[model samples]
Target: MTTPAPLRFRRNDWLELGLAALAEQGPAGLTIEALCRRAGKTKGSFYAHFPAIEAYLSALAGHWRETFTLRLMQEADRGEAPRDRLLALDRMALALDGRIEQGMRRLAQLDAGVAATCAAVDRERIAYLEKLHGESRCFAPAEARALARIEYAAFIGFQQLDLGLSPQELHDCYGTFMRLVYPPSFRSGPRV
Candidate 1:
């Protein structure tokens, strides 16, 4: 029998290490040399996986989108009430503390390619939210879309606030915002 090829580090392994580096030290600090050091690999390995730095960065964007989108969708599918699903998503996003999202957003501001990737991710996320809203029948389509926008904005805004607020305070604030933004049709009725 022919001998099998020895195990080799995959491109995803390098990309994951690069993403970790980006999270720790923003996009500006991300360099191939640093990434290679972190991954304990050589420049040749990086080159073998990606054509160039830009290609690596693009791959990073795709990785982030896939990771974030999957988490959100998984939470959304957890059989909770519609409103609860949205709140769970808000909590999950907050839990991330916006590190990866902030890194991607900053990169987008500086690079057109990154910007396009970020936009595509946003569009995909919004479409997913729209579908959830429709299936839940929690609110009219327009209202659901509007609430989705509000939730997204609030989550991002709180990240930018960087006020070091306690988690309880953040949850309370989110609850209040949800009450205001969600239509009555979407809310649970008063407890008896």
Candidate 2:
């Protein structure tokens, strides 16, 4: 039989490979050489998708923001109620690759574009959380805002902690926080 054609990676394929590299090897792993090796492709393949390293990095950040933050928010919004939305968001967030988020945070320190992307993601996430909390009617506008910040802070902190904490443990901790901080009516709703 004739040999099959060589695999060609598309733009999104390169982006996805970059995310896996980040999760496995951190920011340093994002080098063109590293990524090409991981994909078993050449520099030409990468250049076809990205003009330069800076552009590739920006694209990678955008990819991360789209996949991790925006997509999750959209999916969570599909829930029928605010509490259901919150729980769905929590489950989705917890299921994400924390290592990739940690790598993005690490990259943010060195890249202004990445930093801005991270900041935007943080703002978007908090705003979504605030909206969900307000819709739940468990807290006033200000309280919802504050609670959203607190919740987002916990998520960021938990991702960066890298203390071998499993997602289930994080989810349980979040459930506990919800029980303790949420109103009695909500306390019952957020139970794990």
Candidate 3:
């Protein structure tokens, strides 16, 4: 048999591989050699995409923000009603890989750049949630802000707990949370 051709990786490829590595092995898995080995690529391929490990880490943060937060928000915005938007957002958010989120949180504890990125993403999520809750007319502005934080806390906490929950289990757990916190009038939807 002929020898296999060399692997060629693009920037996004490297970022995706790095994210997977982070999820699988935590921050320790992010070393240049580890990433290269996981991707079956060479140092040259990685260096061509990123000048250094710091740059790679920074890009990985950006990738996470784009893929997990901003994009989900955009998709959720498609729903006309605020309640529908909130449900859509919840569905997508719950379906995300919690391991990656836990990995990102761990990385944030180690890297200031990643910490700042995580902070920004948290703010963005809370702000969107606050807006949705307020617009749903289910709560007053002050209540909406407080509820948003509570909901966000639940999301982060679930990731940390790692209860071996499937997406459906996680969704059901959030539904239970919503049923407990939201008024009965707002609990008629399939989400609850």
Candidate 4:
């Protein structure tokens, strides 16, 4: 039988593959050969999109930056009430790709470019979180700022923790963590 036409992998196709590789194998392991193998394509296809590995990595980080930060900001902007926004933020935070986040943090530790990108993303997340904290109506400005820092750290730490939980179980865990960190006034909602 005649061979089928080669699959057409576009720029986004490469970026998505690269993002997966970033999560699974860190930046140092993001070789063009590995990407090509994972994508089931030849080097030609990869070169068609990115001139080099650095460009591909940059595009992958940019894609994550755009989507990840936007999800937080968009979620934080929802729900007029501070508690509602907090809930939205919590849900978004829990739903994030933990593997990619961990991989990014690991890469950020060694690479200045990745470090800067991670810093910017952290700032964005903290800024949105601070706004929600300000509206929380329980803490003064300095207290809110301090609480937000701790809250964001807890968010990151929880993601790294291997609870081996199913979705509902993790949701329960989030609820428990929220109660520990937030005052009773802000702890309205399911106790589970």
Q: Count of backbone clashes for each model? A: 0, 0, 0, 0
Report the lDDT tens digits of candidate 1 across residue range 1-192: 111222566887876675667677788656888776666667897799899999988888888877777767787679567666766776676566467788888888877888998898877777767766766776788977876666666766776677888777787887787677566677675311
TM-score of candidate 4 to 2 decimals: 0.83
Tell me the spans in candidate 4 whose CA falls farther than 4 Å from its real position: 1-6, 163-170, 181-183, 189-192
Sliding window of 10 residues with minimal summed lDDT for model 4? 1-10
Clashing pairs in 1: none
Ranking, TM-score, top scorer first: 2, 3, 4, 1
Candidate 3 regions with alpha-carbon error over 4 angstroms: 1-7
Cα lDDT tens digits, model 2, 87-176, are 889899999999999999999998999999999999999999999999988789999999999999999998878678777888899888
TM per candidate: 0.81, 0.93, 0.92, 0.83
- C-alpha RMSD for every candidate: 6.0, 3.5, 3.1, 3.8
Backbone clashes in candidate 4 total 0
- Candidate 1 lDDT score relative to the true structure: 0.72
The ten-residue window of minimal lDDT in model 3 covers: 1-10
lDDT of 4 by residue, 124-179 (tens): 87877787888877778888788788878877876678868765676777677668
TM-score of 3: 0.92
Model 1, which residues run further than 4 Å from truth?
1-8, 183-192
